[model samples]
Each structure stands twice: as structure tokens, then as C-alpha cells.
Target: MLHIGNAQIPTCGGLTRRSFLQVGAAGLAGLNLPDFLSMKAAGAVDESKAEVKNCIMLFLVGSPGHLDTWDLKPNAPADVRGPFKPIKTKAPGIDICEHLPLMAKLADKYSLIRSLFHTSSAVHGSGHQWMMTGHGFNNGDPHPHAGSVIARVFGQKSALPPSIILPGKVGAVGDNLGERAQTAAYLGSAYNPFFLGADPAKSDFKIANLSPQAGQTEFRINSRRKLLAELDAIQQQVENASTVAHDTAYQRAFSLITAPETKKAFDLSEEKDSVRDRYGRNTFGASCLLSRRLIERGVRFVTINHFDTVFSIACWDMHADGGSLNNTVQDYERHLLPQFDQAYSALLTDLDERGLLKETVVATLSEMGRTPKINGKGGRDHYPPCWTNFLAGGNIKGGQVIGASDKNGAVPHDYPIDPPRVLATIYQGMGVDLDQVMMPGPGSRPIRLIDAEPIPELF
Candidate 1:
């Protein structure tokens, strides 16, 4: 929580999120939030024709095994099936992991894409680049994230950034080159997703970007604002894209930092204790709840990274190597599965109850799927050849499985789907005319946001 002015937004423990961000002893120009808040040139699109107005993307950082989770091959050999059992859901013929009982109950709300696969390198970074940006960056020309594309097309609807990444941005995941794909590359920093550096789950959490430096009084911050205005006057003479971008960033930052309503939007204390408990009290759960609040307050896109890295911590990367990369079925049964089941289902129910689901799309994605076969250490490894991802709400039809995996859950049995098509479906579901809308491409040329079309079956 941050104390912006005389007003204070408290946490559940009665701590305040209201405080001046001590940007740095150097100056306010070093404010990192404004840097990510920079706006790019808005894309060409007819807003009146759009179907979906908002999206909440839950990105599972460490890819979960499709066989162990959604596409269970019960008849397969003992070695292939793992420990989890599949249970029937509300959606006919759709079964999920037993650990995900809550999500199983709401199966009618989301549609699973079981045949999702990519032929790119089998690295975490490459998968992240493909799923997050809809393009592989091995060729060097990186594309903007899906949220950045939305920001470029729809722009901001309120003081909040058009696109936001909750908790924090993706950090080291082995392949730094591919992991860098989370940013808005050719689309420019203006369209970059705003990363919330602090975790909302923590009682002591405070928005670092909103607070002024330690020992700095409001008078000093205001004086710096005046100084910045003077500097802007001198810089205005240039009147180029860079100047316009910085000007817009500063304006957005000041507005977000000073607005009471914007501060309230970040306040979890405003929510009922039962509501918070329903979403779960962990990092991922709090993020999901925060996403709903953000969408309600006019954020166009909100992406929740379930975990920042696939390291020593318990995550979906169940390599079971008996080392730092180890994560076994126990982790899934005890933590990962239940956490996701609770938070995801709560998000769907909350959004639908608030009437936001009809206009907002919720997407569950991952870097890739784990190996179909169990490993020597009782876990699975990364396998980019096949996986599962799903979409719900908006105009997307539910109670249906869009594609299928083979008996062994190794590859697509029918109607294989790829990453770009998924991104296209999201954009199309949001009501963007894929054929009519074109974003500014590399070198200021007009081009479609994605090369592939939306999956017709999804609609």
C-alpha cells in the first residue's frame, strides 16, 4: 500500500499503501513506472464493432504436463499415466485432474484447447516468446506481447495503463534471449505492459512507483514536478515521437499517482474478507482478485504470471531431478493444483456474477506442456511438441473442447492448433476485425497484429 496524499488505502492488517515513492536520490526522471507507462501510437480499429472489451490472462510460468492435468490417457501404459486421476466436469466428456475440483465444477465456463503445440526450440524462453507474443524470436525481430498489441490497438480506457502485468515481469528462465520477449519490441516501450513491482499478497506491500523517495516531503515532490514542467517546456521544441512518448508517460504517471480513485482500485482492503479468502490468500490468488478489480476500473488487459521462475521453488516444472529443478506430483497435489483451481474458478465466478464475464475473456496459458511419459525421477520434463491451453468468457463458446490429443497425449489427434491462432482468437473474440485492423509494424509500416486467423471453432 502507498500513501499518495492525505488519503490512505489500508491493507487487511490496517497498513497503508499511501506513501510518496522514493524514486531515487537522483531525481523523478529515473521513475521506472513511467518508463513502462509510455504510450505507443494507437492502432487502427473500430471500437464499436468489438465483442470483448477486457481480458485476464493467467500465465502459468512453468508448463504443466497435459497428460497429468487435462488430457489424461487413462488406458495408456502405467509409465505414461502418472499419479493424478481425471474426474468428470460439468461439461460433458470433459475431465480434469482430481486436484482441480473447483475448476472441474466450472468446466462449462471455459473451453480447453488440448492440441496446442509449437515446433520451436524446447526451451522455457522460446515457449514464453511464442505463447506471450504469438511469434518466435529466433529470427531476431521480436514482436509485442498480446497485451501490448491490445494497448496499441485499443489504448487506455482510464488512468490505469491499457496493459498491466501483475506482481512483476518474468525474470530469468534459463534462456534470457527468448525470455526478453515479454516486452513490447518493435511496438515500442509505449505499448509495454505496466509491471506491478510489488506483490499484493503481502501485508507490508507498498507500490514503489507511487511513493516518493524517503525523507522527501510533498513540497519537494511538487517542486520537482514544477522543475519537470520547465524541462518539458524546453524539450517540447523537438516535437518528435520520443518527446510525445515521454510526455504521455509523465502525464499518465502523474494522473495515476495522484488520483484517489486509482489508489482505491489498488486497495484490497476495500474488498470483503470472505471475498479475499475465496480467491485464496497467496500471491497468485491475490493477483487474480486484483485483476478483477483492475478490469472493473477500466484496465484493458491484465496478465497474472503464476510464478516468476522455474527454479528451486515449488512450481509446475515437475522435472523431479532430485536437485534445484525438482518438482514432483506431491507439489501438484499439495499446492499448485489447488491454488490454481481456487483462484481460477473464483475469477470466473466473480467476473460472471459482476456481469464482466460477458465482455471479458479469461485465458489460461503456459510456456509448454511437460513430457507425456513419466521421468526416471517420478516427474516430467518440458515438451514443446504438445500441450493444453484454454479460453473462457466473452464471445467464446463454452462446454466444448476445441481440439484433441492422441491416446498417449503425445500430439494433436485432430485439428492441431498453434500459438498465433490462439492469439488471433483472443483478438477476434475481443471484437477486433483481424482483417480490418492493422498495427504499425517495424519501420512504421502497417501490418496485421498477427499472421494467423482466429480459430473458427472457438467462436
Candidate 2:
């Protein structure tokens, strides 16, 4: 038996009962304590073997159209080409929409993948599953998100969670089939991405999850901890692996609540007004700024959902149906493109200036691309055949276009890249050796993190 304070803990298989009790107690606090314990048990992360220290994933919820954005066809018909004209970027042959002027100036900082496609359904959820998890949903066996996989492999570096999603989790958005992909899935709940349920852009923004309850003082919290420990001592009689996992989560929650560094990490007020303004004052901008802060504070991965859903908003899903989903070219020009251009460019510049770019990988991804031709509603529809996403910083070479589409911007005219390959490339960029590294899959079976090989050209 092992003793902590006034409680006596039994031993099981060389592990003290007090440790298991603490894990169960921490689990009650809503932190995935078991995940850390599991990683320690499996020896997943080896510091000597680690490569990239961090990553920020800017997930554009609604797919952007290739013709209207990156791979614009200036010589195509008026309806097919859309209104915006491509302008020369800093990189010699590359040009993007005129609205993305800020991004155009920083062309040498990033590389565009013009031929990303998947053979899955065109629904938003399907693409979400594929792009986020690197796997198509097979019945209900959803794959773990890339971030969750990272969290599982590396564990937390500080009191703050390793994987975090800003603004909130993706909801609704046409279908819910792939929504589960955002979760830890078979890797277990301990590796789930920490979703910041509040908007940082708001004047009254506060992380409700990180803040203590009203009138709850440090002394009171400590008293409650003691009480919980006493209760855990009693409950330890029925202790099991699940109970230990719960206790571990509670321990993590307690650490987060009391840790000044965790509070400082999430505090945006520390940033200058000018700095905040540079990223833009909107939700997306604030999220981008927060992502930088999180990365600086030892978060391995931060995912910024540009928008939580595609319905009833001026999102990239430019169906232009003139209904709840009425997003048109005007919205893109006046809002989406400009907002993204500022936030993205600012993030890259900020990271580069802070010298974090070399240690971090910044990636922009979407579910799919918009259709090649314009629709009757003056907008493009979903097209899973082809689209454009980009990568920058870390080991990724900048200012180069990897793949190409035909004149109509319809299909992959050159080297065809799929969702898994893109994900594999990201892992590779992060210094993960796909051949040597394996993750624990369903039924505790060891399995490859991803099946596809990384893009050779990227190296």
C-alpha cells in the first residue's frame, strides 16, 4: 500500500493505488490524464527523434473555388473565370486573386498545392473527415484527427493541452457524417483536441473552461482538492483502468486551473492593440493571433476553424442560393478573401519575425474545392475533384506550385495529390518518420499513422 496525506492506497502490478486514484480524480476534472500516462507507458515521444516543434492548421470550413482563387484561368470565358483577376505575386510565375494582395506580397513564404482531390462524397462532412483525419470514414470507424494523433504521440509539454482548437468545434455544416473525425476516436478521449468554446475577437472574450467558477478562491479550490482526494481514497476500492484514466484527467484539470503559465498562455490582453489590429479585429484574425501565442507556449498543434459552420453565414461555401446560404462573389471580395489574406499573411510574417517559423509548420486546408464553372445562382458548388491548399514554414520549400490543373481548372493536369498524401506531407514536414512511427489503433493494435507516402517533391 502507498500513502498520500492521510489516505492509504493499495498496490496493483507495481503501480501504487494513489497514482491511480489521482488519475481518476484528474479525469473528473475533464483533462485527459490517462493519455499522458499511456504515452509514458508506450514511450511514444522521443525528444531526440522529434523534428518540428509545432504546427498551426488554418481550416477553411467552406471550400474555396480553384478558378476564383489560386488557380484562376484568366483566358477562360467570363462565367467560368469569375470576376476577380489574378495578379503577379512575389514568386515569379505564381499569381493569386487581386483581393489577396497581402498574401501576394509574401508569395515566397508559402507553396501552393493546386491539385488536391479525394474520391469521397462531395458533402462537407466527408471532406472534413478526409482532410482532418487523412482517412475516409469507414462506416462508424472514424480516424483520429492529425492533431489528436500528435497529442497522443508527443503528449503535453506544459500545463496547457498539446492540441487545441480555437473559436470552437465545427458543427452542422450540411452533414454530420465526418464530425466524429475531429475527436480522438480509437486513440481514446485523452488525446482529444481542446476546443476553446469562446470567441477571442469579442470585447468580453474569456475562456470559460480555463477560468475558475464565480467566487471560487485558491484556498477553496485547494480545500475541494483535498475533499476530492478523500473521496478518491474511498472510490479506489473499485479502481480500474477507466477509473485511473478519469483520475488522471482530474489531476490535469487541477493543474490547469492553478497554473499561472496556463492562464498567461490564453490571455490575449498581453498583446498590443497594434499587433491585434495587424492580424485583423475579426474572429478569424483573433484566432490566428491566439494560435501564434499558443504555439509559443508549447502547444504542439493549434487548429483555427475560419468559421464553425457553412450555413447562414458569409463563408466560403459560395452557393449564392440567395437563401440562408447566400454567399456570393461580393462576400468573397469584401470579406472572406481580405480577412484571410490579412490574418494568414500576418501570421506568417509574425512567426517569421519571432523566429518560430523554422520550428513550426503553418498549413491552410479546406474540405474540397468549388466547382470549375459558375452556377445559375452566380456562385460555384462543391467539387471534390480538385482544389488548392498550401504549406509554409518548417521544412516546406516556399514559392513553388507542386501540382497543376488543366486550362479549365477542372482536374489534376499533372501530379495528382490526394487528401492522405497531403496529410502525410504535413506529418513529414513535422519530422514524423512515417515508416518508423506507429500509433495504437482500435483493439490496441499497432498500426501505421497514415498509409500514403509523403510528397517527394516537398523534401
lDDT of 1 by residue, 8-103 (tens): 223345543232233342136552332322322432234566657889889999898888888888889888998789999999999999999999
List TM-scores for all candidates, in order. Answer: 0.89, 0.89
**Candidate 2 residue-wise lDDT, 1-459, digit = tens:** 432111223334465656667657767876453343443423346556565768899999988887888999999888889999999999999999999999999999899999888988998999999999999988768999999888766667877788899899999798888779789887767677889999999988888998999999999999988998888777756744455545656666787799899888878889999999999999999999999999998888999998998989899999999898899999999999999999999999999999999878898999999888999989999999989999998888889999998888889999999999988988888887776566667865557778999888877
lDDT of each: 0.82, 0.84
Best by lDDT: 2
RMSD of each: 11.5, 7.4
Number of the predicted model whose TM-score against the real structure is largest: 2
Compute the lDDT for candidate 1.
0.82
Q: Number of clashes in model 1? A: 18
